[model samples]
Target chain A: MKILVTCKRVLDPYVKARVKADGTGVNLDNVKMAMNPFDEIAIEEAIRMREAGKADEIVAVSIGAAKTEETLRTALAMGADRAVHVVTEDDIEPLGVAKVLKSLVESEQPGLVIMGKQAIDGDSNQAGQMLAALLGWAQGTNVSNVELDGDTANITREIDGGLERLALKMPCVLTSDLRLNEPRYASLPNIMKAKKKPMDKKPIDELGVDTAPRQTLVSVSEPPPRAAGVKVASVDELVDKLKNEAQVI
Target chain B: MSILIIAEHDNAEIKGATLNTLTAAAKMGDSVDILIAGSGCSGAAEAAAALPGVRSVKLADSAEYANQLAENVAPLLVQLAGDYSHLVAPATTNGKNLMPRVAALLDVMAISDISDVVDADTFERPIYAGNVLSVIKSNDATKVITVRTTKFAAAEAAGGSASIDSIDGSGDTGLATFEGQDLTQSDRPELTSAKVVVSGGRGMQNGDNFAMLDELAGKLNAAVGASRAAVDAGFVPNDYQVGQTGKVVAPDLYIAIGISGAIQHLAGMKDSKTIVAINNDEEAPIFQVADYGLVMDLFDAVPQFTAALD
Candidate 1:
């Protein structure tokens, strides 16, 4: 059984984001980008599954602009056998991106696929499910744990309150949430070897997948800033204010 | 163009997130049609029918919709999607799971977690846990979108006497079968639904100390929450993490216990109605925006406060 891991390059989580002055978009003039955190977990899991002898080979795939190859290399340094880069300069809508991946899956026919549950950037948490749905495969999302049996894979997901355990048939898709596993950094030796690893590009056009976008963006605006609150003297004053002024009670 | 807002729900009740999606749909276009595709969920349809701004409510109740399985909802939406130019769902777990399939089935790209609509075919979404925002334009004819509900207000419960309409089930129940469901019980309103919430952080020490937050929650009738630090430290589970990474909640009252109010943590709960802080550190950032402040140890103040409530 082979595993395909999906990842993306997004803005680094530590950088503070600022809206553009003209309000056209984010001010990315100097913002640095890195591999998405959850996708890091996805890469690590696929490599672990392969090393554990649970899978035959592990392949890493990334979708984004040219610099996103940096992210695939990051995945390779973490030990994926090969890489598939679906090159698109524009940050295409996730559904289009998923369609490109569905075509990749049809070509690869991997027994299992894993991806980060949500990209830290959009926080949409939809691509993995969309990919599974397009492929007509069983799926589990926000997964913290996964166990593969003969023809089925068991997934432990982080739901709203507690965890839900699901047993999915083989050729399934899984998206990772936090606590799934701590992603390991690429060792110096592996980082050096990753340079030589096969990094193949699949121009989305060659995939024969329709990348047509459906949604139209009307306006992009910043969320209203939180108003500074009035500080109360004591709990008594708070309760009184709640009852008399706020009328929450 | 008309917008189709897909409502997310179990047979029991519609999630508050669905109402927020309606709030977003109202911003997008004049006409709105909601699809409540779940099994025997007349309750859900009734709720959708009552939404003040909606023109039509489409109910596709079926036993197979018990899971609201993506396979089923995808084809149904695809079949029903032609009439409307846009299709949308709340970016909840169910919506995230369902709409991608519909987008794929339609052979069009779908946008996820749209915070603001840029144009009819463009949007701005945050990346890196809201640390960065990206504005992009879509070239698709009829866009599919999933929205983060925290940004929108819940639709008012105005009496609108709406029409109750039905559509045939998309019934493409593929191979997956219904396994049993495990529901978690809590007395307080859900985080997304609660008007108030009190959350703990690593400063609270351990899981047992969570009781202090719970007690305060009960007093406030608020949901219980925890910081990602608390969850990462194993003091609590991931459900409690309130940051760019976890659930986003905007409640009427918010109390932070022993939390320093990291920017990431603030991103999750900052939209709350009123903020309160109970931390030992006098300079904790949580106090900076708190509506009420207790510059004392949470361990000591929590018990005293709970006692005061009792």
Candidate 2:
């Protein structure tokens, strides 16, 4: 069975992102960039399925600027067989990205498709579900475990306060949660081999999806700064502070 | 057009988050309706009717509602969603589970986790945790959205005039159930529904060190949480990981201890009404938006904090 995994390039989660001085967008000159943390889980899960013989081929796909090839290469280094780049220089919202993936899936026809539950940049968490909807496929999000039958996929998902299990008819979309899989590091050997792996590029223009924003972006601003307080010397002090100083209690 | 707020229930009681979504819907427009689709969930609809601002409550109860197995809830929502101009649900596993299919069925796109409603078509949401806010306006005639209840007030029990009505059941909707529920529990808050949260991270040093905040959390009647880094380092259970990869929360008071405030983790707690930080490094990112900040070593702070709380 062929497994498809999706990833995206996002500002490093650790970076204290600053909106551009001019407000055009975030200042990226010196900031770190990497594949979204959740998407890494997706890549790891697909590779694990392949290693387990549950998948015969793993195709890692990313849709973003040309710089995203680095992310696709990272996925290949981690163990995907090849990569597909859905190119877009400008940012594309979740719906447009899903539209592009849906069209690509129609042609690729992988048995299973997996993605991170949401991206760190936008945290939309909608692309996988939207793709599932557009393709008439079943979907499971926040998946902790996946069990596949001949033509059905049984996925255990994380829910509020507990877990729920559902069976989806293949082909299906599954979004990985934090506990789904631990991503493996790219070794020196794998990193070298990744450079030799096949990588293809396609554009949202070719896939026939709207790359336009549905909503206007009026502004992007950093949240306000936190307030200040000091350490209390004792539990009694803490209680006194809660009731008297902060008065939160 | 009217808005549709999906009722959350397990054939037992309505989830608090569902009413939280109602609070968000109340902000959107004049008319709000709650949709309850499950097997024998008319009672759930009756319960939902108790929320304020609901014009009516609709239920399509059947055995199918029990599972919330998307295939069933998807079609049920799509059939009912046609009349409403806007669709909103609390961004839960259930709402996140079914709303996309409804969006797919309607062949329209949806905006998820809006922190604020701008107009009928525009909204504000946090993308990189709470670090960066994105204000988006939807062009779709029919808007579908899942609300971040943390951003909206919980629906008040002040009472409303809505009535619950039982609709014809749609039976089974073709989705299959494979596994049942088995949960992992934590001594802290459930994350999404916590009124107060005290989270720690790598700066906490070790697993046992989390107790510093544990005492404080218990005293606050809040949940204990952890950043992804803390959880990944085995300082805490995965259930405590808060960020894009972990849980997203909005609590009344959030105290982040010894956490450097990665944008990912900050995204989870940025919506808290009051944010208190304990970091030795004054430059720690977690201090950026903390309502209260302490630039002191956690070692000195934790004991002092625990002593004060207990």
For candidate 1 chain B, the 10 contiguous residues with the lowest summed lDDT are: B172-181
TM-scores of the candidates are 0.87, 0.90
Deviation from truth (RMSD, Å), model 2: 2.9
Number of the top TM-score candidate = 2
| Residue-level lDDT tens digits of model 1 in B176-252 | 54454455567777887788888999899899989778877888788898898898889977777788768788788
Highest DockQ, which number? 2
lDDT string for model 2 (B149-221, tens) is: 7777777754776887778766674646656776666676567788788899889989998877777677778
Candidate 2 regions with alpha-carbon error over 4 angstroms? A209-212, A228-237, B184-190, B200-216, B233-239, B258-260, B278-310
lDDT (0 to 1) per candidate: 0.79, 0.79
Question: Residue-wise lDDT of candidate 1 within A105-190, one digit each (tens)?
Answer: 88898998999987766666778877887788877888888887888777777767676676677788889988888899899999
